[model samples]
Target: MTEDAATIPIRPAELAAFLAARMCHDFISPASAIVSGLDLLEDPTAQDMREDAMGLIAASARKLADLLAFSRVAFGASASAETFDARELEKLARGVFGHMRAELDWQVEPAGVNKPAARTLLNLAQMAGAALPTGGSARVRAVEEAASIAIAVEATGPRARLRPEVLAGLRGEGPGEGLHGHWVQARYVNLFVGDAGGRVFADVAEERVTLAATIPA
Candidate 1:
């Protein structure tokens, strides 16, 4: 994406288009695999491949389900209700991360947070889950403050540095040149939290990276 293209004050139509396109790009891969798996299942001559194809189909279905659940809460208009409990987000987070090499340790309370805060928490968890390029663990925690809730997602593993492009995007500096898929989450988190009367911050360390947000009551 160009610097101009990535700049802020992104019109809602354009932002929605971009997110929809990106999400479709992500959704297509597993979905295609599932289709191919079904094709293989129909071929009686390929009986040897049926077991493998069935497994592939099952996994893809799970991923598609996860993507739908995550996208609904993260990008779609949620909060038709006043607040969303942590359990819903936790279930989605576990599904999202389960497909990855990393494990997710969820500590969010049933104590509800508003829709925006919940979205911020889910994005943080997604970002932390991806931070572990190699196999590791990600943890999502919620702390109830006097007037607000603090949401945090921490990833621990070797070579756990926040992507410079993601960090830059979070700071409103735009993702660096040659940016790709990962920059999208950072962009969304920054815009979403700011609009929700919240602040996005993070800590980068050699072994762990934590993305956090403070959302007001």
Candidate 2:
């Protein structure tokens, strides 16, 4: 690591707490939408608006489900080594990013990946999705090794802000007391990777930030 990298300042915990609260806040809207849709279904007039209401309800439910599942792996209270299909991961990633306006250029190979590793990779994808504001493509890949798996996330588009804490998280650093949204994400990723006995590497170049992880099989 360069001196610049080593000297990267840590943010206050209050900031991290605030960022985490903000991220959770965003999910409340979708949960509320689901509730509204359910209430509409109970109304007699809803029969006429049934289709629209149902659509809203289904969309909200799916979004909530995706978010929850992603959170379970990204920010949840448990981390275990299990096996999951790569196709399922791709589907999950697509669903997570589908609501966004960005166009993700995702390519996932067919393979069975350890759950801990999968969760780590998913978190990275979520981070990438947040970075590309003007819309861009993110490439995700997993390579199975004899004793471990290597997962990589590469995103390219109009340059996006790459927070130092985000990079630190990938490099196995804790949240370090910052409340920035990105910092919270970094902490989440760091915890997930650590629980899985993995290491995260980040390469932030001129126009892109590439994150990769090596997880024990």
Candidate 3:
């Protein structure tokens, strides 16, 4: 992450770097949990522990599957007609947040977004999901506006706060010293907004946080 006051577009190399980091970060936890479960299964004297290990493996595998599906659509590149089905995006978000403490309340008018804007919209929602670390609600909204589409995520819960570095990264000022691959989502949100000739903002209250980005119609 850079120290600039203005956000900049991420080049291919940078995007690749971020993707690599995030894939590892998102996949590692559940993957490790699965391995631990396997190890428990290997203990010859732990016959009675089979049921618990099986449950752990099943849950972790499901979480990994959910995350992978969401990431595939959110980060992959493809084209279909001229718009993205909002319902599909909503489903992906639900799948992702369902495995966590957050529940997504989604509202999308017109039922689709211009294909180019979908990624940013989804990324903002994902950011909102990550902000609610203490079991809260994250609302994702996409609405048609004056010559533009506005996407926002409003999250409320106890001890809700955007990590300072992540906030900075989303603001386009880079993550200061912590700019790494895991922060690419925030970076991409800002980058997409700039590419769409729009602005991004975030607000934090005592127990709430909202992150938003816009794209032109």
Candidate 4:
């Protein structure tokens, strides 16, 4: 069946570029902070603030490392591993959540998941964390349901909300007036899930947002 013109998939080149840009946006902040911290440490007149500089450097370094590791599995081709351990995925999710205001609750029932499901879990978990700008909790759950894997993330907080572009992306639509960084991740999840004979869903309510996907096992 032909896709509707308005909901056509993005071109390969465009999608790749958008994804790259989005990852860069995520990394640049902590990378720049590390640099700034180093600059402060080198300033002889600011020796009194040396401890502060070191603290900043250490925290930013950890955050940078965490984001990089999470991105590798969520967005990049994480080697040739066909299946990923659920425990490791939870660690990755926790690493990213440590720096965010939101908390993570990983409750995956499966011991392992295929490539597509792993990516979906990681991306949705991160997206759920993002939904809560203020403090909140993002619960990530995945289980084997017959011949498929069901993944759901519920984000609840003081002001939990899903971005407009994110909804559009999950529906396999373009960003329109939304931010590219947010839209690209959702679109990527949608593409991989659809390719694996699955679908993605998102629902927004007062102080809550839910994201879900199912991938054929």
- The local distance difference test score of each candidate is 0.81, 0.72, 0.79, 0.93
lDDT of each residue in 1-217, candidate 2, tens digit only: 3545334544557545655696687689799998898888899966888888899999998888887766665554235536766777777777789876556665655476766777776778877777677777777777777788888888777875467767766564544554356666666666567777787877887668788888888
Residue 179, model 3, lDDT: 52
How well does candidate 2 match the true structure, expressed as C-alpha RMSD? 5.2
**C-alpha lDDT of residue 44 in model 3:** 94
Task: Please tell me which model should have the higher TM-score, number 3 or number 4.
Answer: 4
Q: How accurate is candidate 2 locally (lDDT)?
A: 0.72
Ranking by lDDT: 4, 1, 3, 2
* Residue-by-residue lDDT tens digits, candidate 1, 135-194: 688888888888888888889998777888788667655555735466766877888888
Each model's TM-score, in the order given?
0.90, 0.72, 0.87, 0.96
Better of 1 and 4 by lDDT: 4
Q: Which ten residues in a row have the lowest lDDT in candidate 3?
A: 1-10
* Candidate 4 per-residue C-alpha lDDT over 74-132 given as tens digits, one digit per residue, 9 for 90 to 100: 98749998999999999999999999999998999999999999999999999999999
Query: Which candidate number maximizes lDDT?
Result: 4
lDDT of 3 by residue, 123-149 (tens): 777788788887788887878899898
Q: How far is 177's C-alpha from truth in model 4 (Å)?
A: 1.1
